[model samples]
Target: MATTWYAPYVAKASGWLSDAVNLADMAQGSTVNLAVTGLSRSGKTVFITSLIHNILSAVHNPNRMPLLNVVASNRLMGTWLEDAGANRLPRFRYQDNIEAMAAGAPLWPAGTDDLREIGIEMRFQPATAPGKLLSEISGTPATITIRIVDYPGEWLLDLPLLAQSYAEWSRATLRLYRRGIRAEAASEFLSFMGQHRHDEPASDEVAKQAHDLYRAFLIKARDAYGLSHLQPGRFLCPGTLADAPFLWFAPIDVPDNTHLAPNTLGALMQERYDTYKREVVARFYEDHFRWFSRQIVLVDVLRALLAGREAFEDQRLALESILQSFRYGSGSLFSKLLWGPHIDRVLFAATKADHVPDVQRDHLAELLRSMAAFPAIEAKSSSARFDVMPIASVISTVEDTQEIDGQRVQVVVGRPVGSDKQAKFFVGTVPIRPPRPDTWNAPFLNVPVFEPPVIDSSPVDGVAHINLDRALEFLVGDRLR
Candidate 1:
């Protein structure tokens, strides 16, 4: 019975688990591998840039993050980056991003395209009385090494696929594509599938063709319709896996209970799908996600609201899929010792709060909470803390009032990139819940890509933001204390 049971365990958890296990780290300092999980263009890069900048700037202008308990209590001594040589992962290009943003003509940093990690050291005075007394006696400054990990957002949608078989996933994807705006975009792939049977002889060429067409449809659906729920999520960013055989397989029509014969198209697909689950998806889950004790899930709620009813519904389904896929819970003292650590705290934020007026920011957060099933997700695990809020990592607009239809409405003024003239945009009233069919009028909002404000590359003049302080407080305050 030695090999009878598949011993479920972690892989490459040595460096990852050290944050939880190493006595040296536990005694002298602690490390929190905070994972930033968000869909593409959800301001993850900007958030990371602003967060690190502000943390370094806290010593200069404590006003930037007054809500962070460490900063509020004046316990934050200073912050600095750790050596990148310590970790084998590629370093996040923070200075290059800052330089790009701080150039004579300002620009926002590019979104994350790879798996990068950065470690920041925060030296602070102990917040707890006993810890403060011990710190005084030992004459050692309390420390926390915050290692932030960022990866392509498309990889996030892959989490749900881990639970689905090739047939099940194909069925669901085809069914969803047949309805709403997706049908038009998927017409080519659907028509291609109409001529091929799943039981046909497996041909590498045919499989690759289908994968290409399906990928094209996914790209079209995303670009033309602003859809974010596409699967095999890494298709767009092939990277080194570009020509991998596992990625050559695509969904085909197959019955739920029908057996895929050996060397059949469906069998190849099923095999490749399983291989992908075991190799690609599982590796990410083990190497990165499992190590995270804290996570920030960023949602561009305003973009969903602006992308029309169908896209909004698509995002809703995506959020629901994520909720159904992952169980976020804190490990008990017993469980942590036995099975390592689990994500204990999560912050689900509605990104780009600057798009809405001050009066509507809470509405933005509430709308995101509803869309993401925040309350229900939180209720499932009382031990874990899941909070939803609206945040703008980089403030790019100024608020003003304008008369619209004989009523004064709040508007935001910003210089949209590639245009010299500043535009005043009045994003329509955002709903706190999904809108009824009749109420969802087309062209609800016009969100423009604004240029970054004049910024000082020096950390002392951290970029302006909204609710970022509170977000930090929720994320790492306990560790500081």
Candidate 2:
């Protein structure tokens, strides 16, 4: 019997047919893929946990989410967790995290470094009268499946590498390391780089040593200096790629427009860099990112501001680089079919909003807006509706007014993490724009990490939050309707 190539074609056609059916089902009762990410310690886990809790709770007690139209209009009929097939992805530990927060002695949940997902099915009455009537006649409410994916924000930093050549990235990264505080932090790594000759024959020992020094510098830059623009993000969160020799490459001071000799240190690093982008970054986009129709990028603005000007600017640059990877637009049918799903809505939220007084919250939002106005980001602003706001996923503080210099100043009172006594915090004022050099020297902003408040385990009561409901409404309100 002669073999035929039609088997592969048949499989591809079948996949397309399946996708068409899925899209049809989505149109009737939408399935939203929501991707959430943030820098280290940016409260990504807490934000996701609270979002799920509030949505599940809102079905029973609409008051819990008054800002969400479905809940506010009493259209949210019910909610339940659908088993995300055991083999697909690791399920998010929603119950375990909720227990930690709602326990007798509330504690913050452990940070997640790996990818996880959860599926929630929401049954709701349609916002439109005709749709509601149709649902009533059928005796079945409309249902939407929301699949949320959580991953480390560090991985997001790797997206920009897809567009740069190894030599270009090396020169750019090396140049960046020599500036301001990065110079101080990268001193050890730079010294190690100086010892090796890029044109010399490749050696595994030298390559691993260089990688270790550079990774160490990246770690210190993030932990000690709060720099956020570090590249090869996987270096910080290796995950399964930890022992992969392909990741043991570091940027070198290769001259622009220079061709590296074959089998040299530069050539080996370049090859591995290309392999990393192909095997690691490209796969991530195809598998996870291309499916997301909505995204939330959590920014720990207060922490960056406190870190000083260089760190703040680095964070702004990092955000600009990361956002470039997202396909942002008013996606048309042709574009959607041809280009895959683009993120229709993106929310750049300043997390830990409760740390600031109410009077300063708008300023925080404005600052984030300014950060997002970078040239690269501004171009994408028109493609998709971009929203910048301040949100506290978990309200860890309470508002209070304090007498300062014989004047009543708004402050927030909260128990600092690891402390039993409550203390009031007033971080002067947040500037609406990036501060000038002189202004930066004024008052140091010292915002403490506050312990999370006690949360009720029941969904009816919901978790305390700031602007979470409003944020949710802006991201997926139209779809819910």
| Best-matching candidate per lDDT | 2
Question: Candidate 2's residue-wise lDDT over 1-481, tens digit each?
Answer: 1113433444365554332233223225667888888888888899999999989888766776889998888788899887867637788889899999998878989877778899888888876544454465456677888888887778878876877899999998999999989999999999989988789999888888999999999999988888899888788877567679999899998987799999899999999899999988878877777888888889998889988888888998888766665544455222342255677778889999999988899899899888765445446554556788899989999999999999999999999977889999988899999888776742243568788888887777788888889998988887676
RMSD of 1: 7.2
Tens-place lDDT per residue, model 1, 1-481, is 1311211122142333323332233237778988886777888888888888888898899999988999989989989988887696788888888888999999889766667889999998876654564466456878889999877667767876776788999898888888877999999998998989899999888888999999999988877787878888778656447678898877888887988899998998889899988888777777776787888888898988888888888777777655442454443222331244567888888999998888889999888888866676567653457889999988999999999999999999889999999888777788888888887767343469998889899999788999898998898877887
lDDT of each: 0.79, 0.81
Instruction: Judge candidate 1 against the unseen true structure and give its global Cα lDDT, from 0 to 1.
Output: 0.79
**Per-residue lDDT value at 155 in model 2:** 82
* Cα TM-score of candidate 2: 0.90
Error of 1 at 119 (Å): 0.7
- Positional deviation of residue 237's Cα in model 2 after best superposition, in angstroms: 2.1
Instruction: Give all TM-scores, in the order shown.
Output: 0.91, 0.90
